[model samples]
Target chain A: MKFTILGTGSATPITERRPSAALLDLGNESILLDCGEGTQFQMLKYKVRFSRIKYILITHLHGDHFFGLIALLNTLNNTGRTEPLVLIGPHGLQDIIGVQLRYSLSFLNYTIDYRTTNPGAFEEVFSNEKISISTIPLKHRIPCTGYLISEKPALRKILAERLPPDFPLPYFKMLKEGLDVEHEGKIYANAEYTLAPASPKKVAYCSDTIFDLGIASYVYQADLLYHESTFTKELSARAQMTFHSTAEQAASIAKAAQVKQLIIGHFSSRYKDTSAFLTEAREIFQNTYLSEEGKTFRV
Target chain B: MKFTILGTGSATPITERRPSAALLDLGNESILLDCGEGTQFQMLKYKVRFSRIKYILITHLHGDHFFGLIALLNTLNNTGRTEPLVLIGPHGLQDIIGVQLRYSLSFLNYTIDYRTTNPGAFEEVFSNEKISISTIPLKHRIPCTGYLISEKPALRKILAERLPPDFPLPYFKMLKEGLDVEHEGKIYANAEYTLAPASPKKVAYCSDTIFDLGIASYVYQADLLYHESTFTKELSARAQMTFHSTAEQAASIAKAAQVKQLIIGHFSSRYKDTSAFLTEAREIFQNTYLSEEGKTFRV
Candidate 1:
């Protein structure tokens, strides 16, 4: 599993550092987290295919976090998208989108399965064959929730090298089922013809939240953790005043949670140079990484 | 008198070609025409300062034409702008922004002087010392209107070389009033010390309109004409069906209006390469140019 950072800037309109957004690619499908303004451009720059997206999870109603959603939906309609997509967000999001559609005179060509998130608790929000998503209540000025996407373990992979060049396609499923196949007077043993499935990975996406040790428990032992670090250590007071976290605070959460890797983003527009954030974050967590637009991290 | 092309693509979202938007720079103040999705990024990329923008003129209710407006206003408020902004658009724009503000729980620090455009008329909408804006009725799927901006005649320029080393600042206005400056018993004749004001330039912006010769009368002899060219000659039928103009049709309007220069934009997304549009338009109007992002044209 892999997740790509689409935008890193916080609630401000900075040209280079865009607002909050990220894409979680699960090979066959993708999920969008906190689609901020101009996120489509970031997706385009990253060569993201529109058809691959299956779900969109919005953390809150902040304009920087979800303002681009209506237009994005309209564009999807214009581009002739017919697949039904799922949308999960806080309360009032549906009303906001409904009002925008009425004023803009827009029509949707497909269905939007709406799911509202309960920002007060940490619980399972959605689940499918590919992945299961849970909400992580975040401490912020507004009611907000982060998402934890846990990939489902896959079936065993067929070893292409052990199979004959003309091996029948029907036996691949049998191999995945831990069954041996005999074809054309030859027997292929499942033990030697298949590999075990890779361990399922978990990716946690936290957007716009204050520093709280409670966040560590929600994202505990995640393969990859993306947390908001709106300020540097020098601006910790400002961060707390705005109900946002500093880079050091986010790194501390990663260290406490013991996640495999941590990516910090959602920087405030006050600082043009984000190198200081990385420097401060790395001081607390050794495996800390700064989130950059269009960069993907494997989980 | 300069205008920059911020976006050129029509309703559909394309990675390389953005939607329709333009910036008119009038030295001290700027006016934005048809702000599409991601127009702010275009403004940021082109270095269009927000404080200098005094007015925004939207042509229609299409999402691609004005979806970015509310978010832009929010950003302006976040950046601590207290200056009042003028927004002139369709009937439901104020209500749209109001609903968005109410749902997002956002408060504006600055006032927005809202004005609804009359799509069926050709009359002066706004006037100031620098420019006068008038409406041009356009034929489109929805209620659409174009803008004709006429620059006001400027005061006569003072010839710095003809003045004494310590020429007083108070006499500059007298020189513009065609009077001789009596400084230190020296007579500096206004006729010899001043240059006549350059003729006022006019720019006509026609967005999302079908081919119609009636437009020629409204934009007659404009210094620069920006007309929609959503299709090439090969797609003339599609253009007519969609109420869009072909490149040749835009060039025809330029030729009929006797404009000094023509910049055609709002190109259909189907055509990956726009060279054919330039070739088609240039065939009718030799001075025709393609609207490229960030390129400024002097009127």
Candidate 2:
């Protein structure tokens, strides 16, 4: 799994940092997370294959998170995209898009499978053969939710070296299923012909949320965890009042979750240099990385 | 008056060309004409002093023409802009932005004085000391209105060298008004001290419109006329079907209106090279110029 950061700025717009947006590419398809204004332009600048995006997941109804949706969707329509797009967001997102499109005098050729996830729940919201998605309830001024995208476990691999040179292809499925296969009156043991698959990967994304230690279990042991660090610890009071998290608080959440790696972004516009956030976050979470625009992180 | 081209593409978003947007600066304040998506980024890219923008005029309800407005206004608010803004557009534009802002949970620090225009009639919508703005009715798929920003006539120039060194200041206003003054029982001819002011300059902007000859009178003798050339003459049929104007048609309108200079833009995304548009437009009007991004035209 590969994660690309499109925008790193918070609600405010700055030239150095864009608003919140990211792309998660998982081989089969990609997912767009929290499209802010200028997301399309950033996607073009970063040379992302935006056409491969099959699902779009939005966290909340904030302008920074949802303003770019109409533009992207309309551009997609104008560009003649026929593949169905699945859009999952808060409850009122569909109606808002409907109104904007109505005013735009538009009719899309591709069908939009609009779905809404309860920001107050932590249940699985989407599932496919390659991955499963669940919501992480977040504490924000508005109804906000993070996403936990977990790659589905692959089938057991066949130890081809152990198999005979002329092994029948029909028995490969049984061996991959970790079962013994008796083909042509000969027994093939599961352990001798098969090996266990690697562990599945999980990426958790959180933005525009206040410091909440109680929800650490929602992102426990994720392969990669991206949390908002809107301010430094010195401005912890301001962060709390604005329903945002400081770098130290995000690092604390990462440490409590015990994730493999932590990426912090959604920086406030007041900060010109982000080195302080990195230094402070790394003090608590040793495996912390700063999310920069156009940078890609691998899991 | 100085005009800066912000975006030049049609509805479709492309790398080489952006959507429709422009800035008209009249020294004291500026006016934004038809803000499209990524307009704020273009403003930043072109180094526009956005704080001085006092009036925002939108042509229609198309997403490309209106999506970036919310982001711009929000950025202004975040940057502590307390000066009120005047927004003039179609009838439903205010409610559309209102719905978007309501969903975004936004409360602006400054007030927005909203006004609507009739796309079927020509009338003045805004007037200030610097300029007067009128709506130019255009034929389009949607109810769209172009803008005619006319610079206010300057005060008559005083030949200060012809006056006495100790001339009283009380008569300056009268001299500027071009009235013969009697100072200390001495006759001072208005013609001897004052010269006629330069004629007022006017700029006409039309986008997403068809080739309508009836509207030529509205932009008659404009200093600069910017009209959309969405297609070449070869695709005049397609342009007619889409309710857009071709380069030749725009040139025809410019020639018919007797405008001083014509600027054509809003090229269709199908063509990457825009020299063809310039070549065809110049065939009919020799004084035509291509509206390129970041380029400024002064009148």
TM-scores, all models, native as reference:
0.86, 0.92
lDDT leader: 2
Which is the leading candidate under TM-score? 2
lDDT of 1: 0.89
Expressed as tens digits, the lDDT of each residue in B50-144 for candidate 1 is 88888999999888898788778887888788999988887888887887787667899999998888999998888877789999999998889
Evaluate residue B106 in candidate 2 and report its C-alpha lDDT on the 0 to 100 scale: 78
Give residue B131's error in model 2 in angstroms. 2.6
> Which candidate number would show the highest DockQ if scored against the true structure?
2
| Cα RMSD over interface residues, candidate 1 | 1.6
How big is the positional error of residue B5 in model 2, measured in Å on the Cα after superposition? 0.9
Residue pair clashes in candidate 1: none
- Reference-based lDDT, each prediction: 0.89, 0.90
Q: What's chain A's TM-score in each predicted model?
A: 0.88, 0.96
The sequence of per-residue lDDT tens digits that candidate 1 reaches over residues A1-299 is 78899999888787888888899988888999988887877787889888888899999988889877887888778878999989999998888788767756677989999999999899988998888999999978888999999888888998898788998889998999789899999888888999889888899998888889899998999999999999998888998998899999999999999999999999888889999999998899989889999899988
Please give the range of 10 consecutive residues that has the lowest summed lDDT in model 2 chain A: A96-105
